[model samples]
Target: MDPSQFSSQPPEAYKSSGKSGMPAAPPPAYQHNPAGYPPSFLNQPVPQGPYTQGPYPGQPAVTVQPAVFVTAAPLANPVPDYLAYSIFTMLCCCLPLGIAALIYSIFTRDANNSGQRELAEKNSKTARTLNHVALGIGLVVIVVIIISQIVIRTAR
Candidate 1:
């Protein structure tokens, strides 16, 4: 195959890259300094492109975006405020409050394992149950006392 096929022009007209305004090689002689001077040629500034100045009119500068660090752990959400309040209310009272709390506890227990919800529900239920029992017993004792008083009064 003819080598002439490789280029647009004839081989006889070939010129060294230097003749075409391209770099030939490094300037041959380096001035050696007894003090061990750093080379000057490498320090020369490379030709800069127009874009290197800064961000373009509408475009952002070419920046390396910070990688978002994601974790295997799931994201957390805040517990609803009303649920927290209800559970608190149940604890302070003694009677029927306990019954209501028990209902809430059972209903929410599974749903609340978000840890916060479960704990609040559990406490509220406990309070309600305590109050409900206390109220029930207290009412019975009062009724018995009233009936005895009426009987004594009638005998007199």
Candidate 2:
């Protein structure tokens, strides 16, 4: 006969009311919006921050047609400094060649900023090609000299 097991309604079918000798609060009444929208939309999301609903300060913005912005993107090209220096350094073996490389890079950088990427790319490629040709010529001359020396020694 434990006191904890004693109950009038077997405890399973009983519900605890919050009120102690007083009436409990009823559910909130649904209020109709004056805009004639549904009551469920009372907590619907609204646009936040200046990006969606506001523009720059002090200026009233007019929304233009998005289709009007269908312009092609301007091409871009830049002569990297390291590439130029490496080419000149290999050929000239002089520090002053670095100055020439810097000048070319600067001119190309300007051209690139001005939207003349094709011209910049053409010049950059030409410079590299010229350097390769110069290198090939140098190698050929060295080989020819070595072969002539070997022939002369064999005849002696």
Candidate 3:
């Protein structure tokens, strides 16, 4: 490709103006300071001595209150005692209900780990209820066995 195709006008048209077709404006009035501080800071009056309670000679004395920041309470996670009950029921009570309780207890942990607090709470309640059911069934069975033994002995 020919480089001359990029230019629509002669080189004399580019001499007076920039790429925008207008002459560039002068820079701002502020001078760049090489010492890192602003140019205005160079002319400012320095402090006479150590800062006291009173104001400067021409300035008004202004009182400022110290800031007080209060942080919010931390989030507390819920603790569900489902696993312990499930384990106890599994050992000493009905096997099927105890297994269901154990499963729900595991689900509670999983929901808690996944940050589903509501689901975790629901699972925890279910596990506890199953544990109670297993315990009730175990107790009823024990009572029936005891009553049957009493009846057999009385009949003899």
> Which clashing pairs does model 2 show?
none
Local distance difference test, each candidate: 0.51, 0.55, 0.77
How high is the lDDT of residue 80 in model 2? 43
Model 1 agreement with the true structure over 10-82: per-residue lDDT tens digits: 4545545545787444456755533323233555433344334544346777978899985332115523224
Worst 10 residues of 1 by lDDT: 72-81
RMSD of each: 16.0, 12.0, 12.2
Which candidate ranks first by TM-score, i.e. highest? 3
Model 3 steric clash pairs: none
Q: What's the candidate order when arranged by decreasing TM-score?
A: 3, 2, 1
lDDT of 3 by residue, 1-156 (tens): 889767844466645665676775555566554453323344554444343245545789899999998653322585484898898899898999999999999998877766677788889899999999999999999899999999999999
User: How many collisions per candidate?
Assistant: 6, 0, 0
Summarize candidate 2's per-residue lDDT along 38-141 as a digit string, tens digits.
Answer: 33444554444434554444679888776655443334445542455545655554344444554555555655666677766765665554445555655676
lDDT of 1 at 39: 35
